[model samples]
Target: MTLETGAPENGPIMLDHDFFRDPHPVYREIKKNGNKPTEVILKTGMAYIPPGLKAWLVTSYEDIESVLRDPRFAKSIADAMPLFAANAPARQEGGGPGRSSLLYDNMANNDPPKHTRLRKPLNGIFTSRAVAPKRADIERAAAETLDAVAAAHRGRDGFDLVQDFAFPFSIAVICDTLGVPVQDRAAFNSWVQTITGAAGPEELARDAGRMAAYLRDLLRAKRTGTEDDVLSLLARSLDEDEAVAQAYALLAAGYETTANLIVTGFLTLEADPQQKRRLWSDPALVPGAVEEMLRHQSPFNLSLYRYVTETTVLNGVELPAGAIVFLAFAAANRDDRRFARPDEFAIEEPRREHLAFGGGIHNCIGKHLARLEAEVAFGMLIQRCPELSVLAPPAADAWKVSPTFRGLRNLRVGPVPGISETGRAHD
Candidate 1:
């Protein structure tokens, strides 16, 4: 159903269910229709202008950037309760505190002064100065995981990259950084899987409560004991309730996105051998490669929903106060106006601004860490596993299922001849 538009219509559009499932086609369609700023209102009442929110999908890069950085647009999901209620399912029992983390909840979710206060402590912890010491540990863990994968293959033909390499590598690094016990890693992995799965709102709520309780117990233990981990640091720095929020935020922010990056990076490299070869030859290129990967395969396609605190005009489209906006970072990253050859993946593309980590006060706090991890992980993988190739037949069907994160559920890899079992450089 199309919205009644008093404004002039400039293009043809289709409202199809597939649009939600795979929006690239729809985006292509929108782009093919020309550059005129027209609107396609969805049956769900979300408008797609071009590259913005699904509901109000703004197509223009400038418009999306404007809305993203604008103070008038509310960053908190709570602010858009009515809009979410209309589109998303109702909340389930035991959903616990809705806003959980300083990054995801009160601070990142809130606007202006409150956000600033909430983020200050976290900003201190995640800055380059603070996180620098952890780099060696991160690299070591990634190397060890790759070593294990190499060992497991043991001159074998193939192994699942996601399971054997990427998943373990990312999980181990995050668990180590957070100081979560190695013994508890399995349980935490299970919890994260349940929490992130395609469950109903009620299921998610229940999972959130369980996870929160688990974190609370961990925080209590850290406070009472003599340990020096992130949890302990947080316990010392924050109040009990705030500690819970921090723990929850770390779990939510750290795992899913990193896992996606690992899987997507591998897959993208496998698809483009030349690019992979270039990266393998020059390890220093990993940093730039990570940025290109982020631009090419944005893990968080949908923007965290924001509410309009005051009336705003996004790309000349007047949005009333209380309007819910989903800043489509995935779409904006591919905006032809801002990006040359927006559809193609070019690692050397001039370092133009991309919203992969988002923008404004609510940008990802773990951005540096995420980039570092991906760069190290992928850089090592290509260099160490020279014979790595897709085990599955080359077909689009080989891709995995996940709406929020785009990555392989199972990416099989074949080892190169002469590579050692421990992923060490072989003669």
Candidate 2:
């Protein structure tokens, strides 16, 4: 379905199911309008904003980067809450606010110096240098997860990659990094799903509060515990609420996005068998391949809503004060101006700046760790499970329902001839 460029007479363009499953074509259509911003609305429950609310969708690399870097575009959730409150559709019974306070309180949703202050303690920890030491742990976790997947489905038709491998594996690593107890780890999947899913206000509130309480308890435990995880570090430095909020952001950010990256990365390889073969032939290309995966199919379709603090011109378009803007990273990464043959997934393509992890001060802090994890994930899959392939064509409802995030609901694979519990192909 073609995306209409101008403002619709009825309302903002309603994003259809096709748009969620495959957004590149829609993005291409939007970018065709001389790279101008278009007003659009996400499907109900698919966005952090109220569904059917009109928002500016910035499609071009130049415009998105400009918005990300410009202080005129505020990142604070408080700035955007009034807009949601005014424009939000009537909530169901017992639904007070559209979003929980826990979501709005974090560094990701705040402008500096609040954003600066909150991110300061985290800056040193997530850098490439600091994250390098965790490579061994990431690899071990990936291998173990793969082993379980192979063993469970050795003779079965197929097994879900997301449920059996990617989601659990990614959550395990993040939980370990955060020092969440093994018993408490199981609750995270349910908590994160409700918080991020297209759930009602009460469900969102309940999950957010539960996760917040869990983080608070974990932080309290870390005060006297001997663990050296991220939570322990935050426990010593920040107060209870501040630390819990940051921890919540970390958990939310580090969990689904990374898991989706792994699943999508494999999907990219499956689509381009030559690329998969190239990686298997030469493991050295894994890192660059991971970057290409990020660019070709970024895990996030758009950046979080940035409110216009004052009237400003972005990409020759005037956006009034309090206007809501969403930077379409998936769209910008596919802009032909920035990367030649942007639609194709090619590892050998020359390096270029892509907005996959976003840009500017509010950019993703866990980017280095994310890249490292993807590299390990792709490398291990190629080196060990060379015979692996997607079992059948992905189902019509394969993609997750979130408007902002892109990930598979489940990916089936296997019915291996000779796969061992070790996850190695035994011919």
Q: Highest lDDT: which candidate? A: 2
lDDT of each: 0.65, 0.78
What range of 10 consecutive residues in model 2 has the weakest lDDT sum? 1-10
**Which 10 consecutive residues of model 1 have the lowest summed lDDT?**
44-53
Query: Residue 164 of model 2: what lDDT?
Result: 84
The TM-score, computed over Cα atoms with residue i paired to residue i, of candidate 1 is 0.82
Model 2, range 1-427, lDDT digits (tens) per residue?
3334455346566676677778877787666667777777776553246666667888888888778778888877666778765555654576543334654578888888888888888889889999999999999888877777767667677678789888888888888877887787778888887766667777777877778777888899997888888899888878777888888889888978999998888888888988778787888988888888888889996678887878877666677787778888988888888878888889877244888888888789999999988888877777667778898767868886676778888888764333444556532
**In model 1, which regions exceed 4 Å deviation?**
1-22, 33-54, 86-106, 350-352, 393-403, 416-427
TM-score of candidate 2 against the unseen true structure: 0.92
lDDT of 1 by residue, 4-84 (tens): 321335532433434444557766765665432344443321111112122445555777777767778776544555555
Please, what is the TM-score per model?
0.82, 0.92
The top-ranked prediction according to TM-score is 2
